[model samples]
Target: MTDNKRFLLRRRPEGAPVETDFELVSDAIPAPPAGGFVLHNHFASLDPAQRGWMDDAPSYMPPIALDDPVRATTVGQVHASDHPDYAPGDWVMGLNAIEEYSVVVPDGFTAKVDVSAVDSPSRFLSAFGAVGLTAYFGLLEVAKPQPGETVLVSGAAGAVGSVVGQIAKIHGCRTVGIAGGPDKCARLVERYGYDAAVDYRGKSAEQLADAIREVTPDGANIVFENVGGTVFDAELMNLAKHARIVLCGLISEYNSETKHGARNLWQVLAQEATLHGYLISAYVDRFAEGGAQMAKWIASGEVVMDEDIQHGIDNAYPAFMRLFSGANTGKLILALD
Candidate 1:
């Protein structure tokens, strides 16, 4: 019998995960039931949320238990099937573990997709999957950007940020993206259509806030927060009247030993800004609606997918580490085959 390699959570991570936090093991493929599908995995989605998933905390989803196969969002090709809805050779994306193969149930997961229509199959996990959905419902549904408003997006050159900035620009909002370096800042403006991009590498939180205020003189109308730490505190101090803050992620504090709390959250009341945090899975029923619109924009060249895929599944740990260090340019993902 052939063995499938999978990554499992050995113990709760102390801070940033090292190889010891996970254990790679080979397992035999189990027999499929009468109506299940067996898939040979290809790509796995590495997200900052996965860090929270490893911790035993009250979150949008349950945390992975010790000795459990590490939970993740992944895409793969069907190798065998018993369900009438699927067949061999069909490409699919869904919530699965980081493994070489998986037995997917028809319920509680997304069906197979046609990857040829988009830039890459990996985009299903990115611009068209969780990232796109996060950008869509968070920015459009939650923030409700109006024309001529100033929108500030943190982690603005990363996976969800790239999409959020583009969507804001599409709505005719003055978009400002905050990233780590100059190259990412440039790409945010030149490629993703942000009105301005700020590099936060050498600047202090206060200086970054000043730069944001400079780009948005009237104060930020919307703050799409992906990195929550001192940045969120600074952004809180610059909110316009009745502004909206959509809390998408907080990668900055993901691996922190001592969690940082928002000190300037009182500014929400002072600035008359509303802060809302949500998970994309909460809006799963409306995915088709958002996906179709995003697809149309992408097809019309209105939205672009800028994915940064690492070469192999073995690179999953390293690729995941990149998110913490701000090493990736766009959607950070792994390609196994």
Candidate 2:
């Protein structure tokens, strides 16, 4: 057997994760057990959710135990298998880890994929993967948007938020995005078909609220919030009567110790609005339904998704940090070579 490289969690993160928190170690590659397969991982999907799993806290999922590989969604080819459905060299996608190889079973999220459906296999990690699925289900199901309503999205340039804006537009809702910089804000309107884009960088809570109100004079009818903390607080202040707020992610507070959630949740009660906490896992059974429609949207040019792919498992730490640094424009992927 050869060596399988893995980036394991050496210690829990303090504030933001650093290189020292992880250790890259090589272990002997083992054969697949009964009803399981060995996957030769090609791409690992980097996400903000991984940061939440790093902490030893009670959450929607269990924390990543020390000395274990950092959990992530991966795409690869079947290297060896005992399962009847899997064959050597067959392409697959599943919830694995940041490793060159993984032992996989036919979990609900694991399945063989048709590589010809996408331009590249890594596209499965971006546009057609979990983030895209999150946008599809979270908006259409949880937010329950209406035509002609104004939809405001925070973290609008991100993987999930970017897709949310386009889906909102497809549903006939007027889309406005709130991103951090001028460049990202521009893409929200130009690339993602948002009606307007609000630059949230260097703005106070009141200032952000004023900006949002300027675009949406009557206030936003639907707020798809990805960034929590102050951004969420601002959105609360600018909600229209009976607005729907879909809480998909709290990216701003993901790395921080002192997590100050949306401070103005009372706005929900005041405006008689609905604030929904969205979890993509709830819609896992409907992935095929969402994936089919999303593929159609991509084929018709109604929706576009971007990816920033980086090479090598050695560069995992810096690559993961790009999510928080606002450096990556879209889905961040790490390819092991």
Candidate 3:
């Protein structure tokens, strides 16, 4: 039997999670049961949504229970299998626990990964994975942006936000990005094809609104909102008539005890704007359709993919914290091998 190391949830966090909230335990890796497969996980995804999964609250998915391995999306090679569809050497991606090894049934969010289609296995967790799919469906299906419209994206340097900005550009819309720090702001304009960028590092909501207005004189016709709190307020103040807001994530409020409700929601009523909150899982039936389009754009040089990767499972907690602190500029990944 192989010894497997896993991080188990030990306590529910009050605000931001600390490393002490999890307990690392080692045990023999379990063999696959009938029709199940064993995966030797190599990379695990670090996402802002993981914070919500830690809380014992009603959500789209069940909360992670104490003493259970921390839930995560992982890419790995199959080490053993009793399933007909899976083999020992196949590469796969699935929603598995954060551990060196996992035994899972080939159901739910599990699928074989075609490594030949992308640059690396990690891309399955980033641009080519949930991040890309979220951007695709959120912008095209939800927002339905058109040419000459102004598209505003918060957390624009992040995985999903960056992709949202680029996809908006592909649709011939004027793209504006809101991110922390000058470096990330510059990256949004220079690298991600954003027409303008607002640095929200030390700016007030009014300041952010003014900056956004300077770039988009007609106001933003479509808002791809990721970071909430003041960022949402800033964007709220700059919405065009009948603007569409595609709500993807609320990273800023994820770790806060008292979440900041959008103060300018009345703007939605005043401007006749539409706000739509979505879960990527809802579009699972059409994932292949979205993935194909994103892959085409990636190959044609229309979309640029970026990832921030850290090595070792021991650094998982710190790496996860980087998402909240804005230390990571793109999709944050933890490479176990």
Candidate 4:
């Protein structure tokens, strides 16, 4: 058998991920076991959480073992099958490694999408994958938002944050998004139905805080916190009484050499604000319920799944880095042959 190409985690990183930390190596596609199959990978997801996976630290999900193919959620069509449940031509989604093809150890992969309905199978890797599910459960369950409350979402134009703001809107909240630039801010309001949007570039922390507060003078009642660090501190000081802060992603601090802490936590105590950090994987039990709801929203056009897909799998590292640069307007994906 000839070898195939895969990106392996060469070593743990000191901070931000660099291409050198990952080595692209050729490896063989192992033969499927009695109940397994091979999927011709087409699209692989690039998520901010991948950064956390690169570190050798405790997290909701275990770190990717060194020298192993970097972990990712991927969408592909099965070309060979030995499992009764999944046959040839089946489009499935699951936690797959970074490679052109994958050997599915039957019962190892969870079928998330049929692929036929979406037309574009990559949607499964975006809206219906971890990114979409994360937004759904994080906002609906963790925030437990009420109608008419102001909900502010950081990383507002990205995959999870984009969905979070829209879900808040569906619940009848006044949605505000904080993105990085004018284009993203525009998309947040124009494309995703955010009530307002703020660009945080070239602004002081106080100015950013004021900008966010101006839209919800009484203070935000619900905040879908994605980018932490200074932004977290700013949001903490502007919480409404009994506000719910759903800690989703901390992309801003993900690549920092030293962990950053918020000093304004005292505000939470004073305002009686509730801050809850969630890992979507922990809510796998609710995936069916949440996926059903998201699908309904998608069908009804209440929620939109905006994706930013790059052309090749070799671009995975750059796609992953885009999250920190605020280069993606929605879910970032890498397409393979």
Estimate the overall C-alpha local distance difference test score of candidate 2.
0.91
TM-scores vs. true structure, each candidate: 0.96, 0.98, 0.98, 0.95
Model 1 alpha-carbon miss at residue 9, Å:
1.0
Model 2: worst 10 consecutive residues (lDDT sum): 122-131
The list of candidate 1 runs beyond 4 A from truth reads none
* Models sorted by lDDT, best on top: 2, 3, 1, 4
Q: What is the C-alpha lDDT of each candidate?
A: 0.86, 0.91, 0.91, 0.83
Residues 71-175, model 1: lDDT tens digits: 878888888889888888899888888888888886666667888886678878877887888999999989999999999999998888999989998899999
Q: For model 3, how does the per-residue alpha-carbon lDDT over 36-55 read when each residue is reduced to its tens digit?
A: 99999989998988999999
State the weakest 10-residue window (summed lDDT) of model 4.
106-115
In the predicted model 4, the residue pairs found to clash are: none
Model 1, residue 178: distance off in Å is: 0.5
Clashes of 1: 0
